[model samples]
Target: MNTRTGKVIVNQTITADGYSAGLDQTEEHPFGDDGGDGWGSSLHSWMFDAGEENRAEVDQINAASAVIMGRNMFGPVRGEWDRQWNGWWGDNPPFHAPVFVLTNHAREPQPMEGGTTYHFVTDGIESALKQARAAAGDGDVSIHGGATTINQYLAAGLVDELRLHIVPITLGAGVRVFDGVPPRKLEQVTARAASTVLHVTYRVLA
Candidate 1:
């Protein structure tokens, strides 16, 4: 029997200053500015530029059975879905599992190649989590965030494990993690250092 023993993991890549993204997010700059090059150049270089060095972390990121992300993380589209936007990833997204997107606007379930599907939840975060948990079963439900969404989960004490990929650079100001989250104790689970990023896992203590 498949046991639903998987955790609700919040996996994010943040700057040294705790910002997950920079200001003025646009279609051209999905991840916004990184102070240096542009967009995800500084914040996400660890995954792209140094993938070999962080292969284990990369694999763990995609190992989730289901994923939940905010509408902004889904795409640049805003306010009632003016146009048809699939997602940041192409036809075959990396998740390769069910993805529950938190959005105020309702949308039909978008099925993609390689077993990936996007299910928009108009209800709320808890509702989305319930659906993601059902879809995940024995696999973990990964909270793929853009800071705001992660902050909500954190504030609500819904996250089980918090996995952070800390980059060296700083964004000064932007969408940040733990912006509205209340104080909580976290037990360090594991920590690893790569060439470009440091991966740290923490158990959200109750």
Candidate 2:
């Protein structure tokens, strides 16, 4: 049977120690580690490896109509920065759909060069999800990361699918992915292994 419904898909990578974003992700140290030792290089390599079939998977994930992210994942650079920074991605961001950012502070909607529009949602995650679902239409609604945001939806059982890439490196101290998540059953939908990353996809069973 075919069913048209709003779905939240989370894409995230964490260290073996379970740190999602890393420590103190300031502008200077975007992925943390202060520039000396960081997972940015590995993370990018893992995501953009054209040879790997996972790149195609990522492309399909972004083919949806909308994306949702938390304010912190947007950037702390927005605080002291004068110019508007869309995201780490350049003018042609991969996400061509409307991207809703969850934030407490209100800001004007930013339309980027590509088809991506960053809409700030001060209302809350539920509001963001509603807007994203409407924008998505028949397509899926993806909940893009930064741990806290994903956890918010997860705790509420709002996510439909979760795609995680677990890297081998471990950061002894940093943010955790499933830090306080209550034990819940996740039905494994798919599992694959690439040269650098292990891709695991799960569907929330309960």
Per residue, candidate 2 scores C-alpha lDDT tens digits across 1-206 of 55777667887776666667567777766678512345366555567653455676677577778999987778765543366777877788788999999877778888987798889898999999999998998788888788888888888888888888777776666666777778879999998887777878899888
Q: Over the stretch 28-102, how does candidate 1's per-residue lDDT look in tens digits?
A: 888777675556887888999898999999999999999999999999888887787889899899989999999
Best by TM-score: 1
TM-score of 1: 0.96
Return the clash pairs for model 1, or none: none
lDDT of 1: 0.92
Off by over 4 Å in 1: 1-4
By how many angstroms RMSD does model 1 differ from the true structure? 1.2
Report lDDT per candidate: 0.92, 0.78
Instruction: Please report how far candidate 1 places residue 69 from its true position, in Å.
Output: 0.2
Listed per candidate, the RMSD to the true structure in angstroms reads: 1.2, 2.5
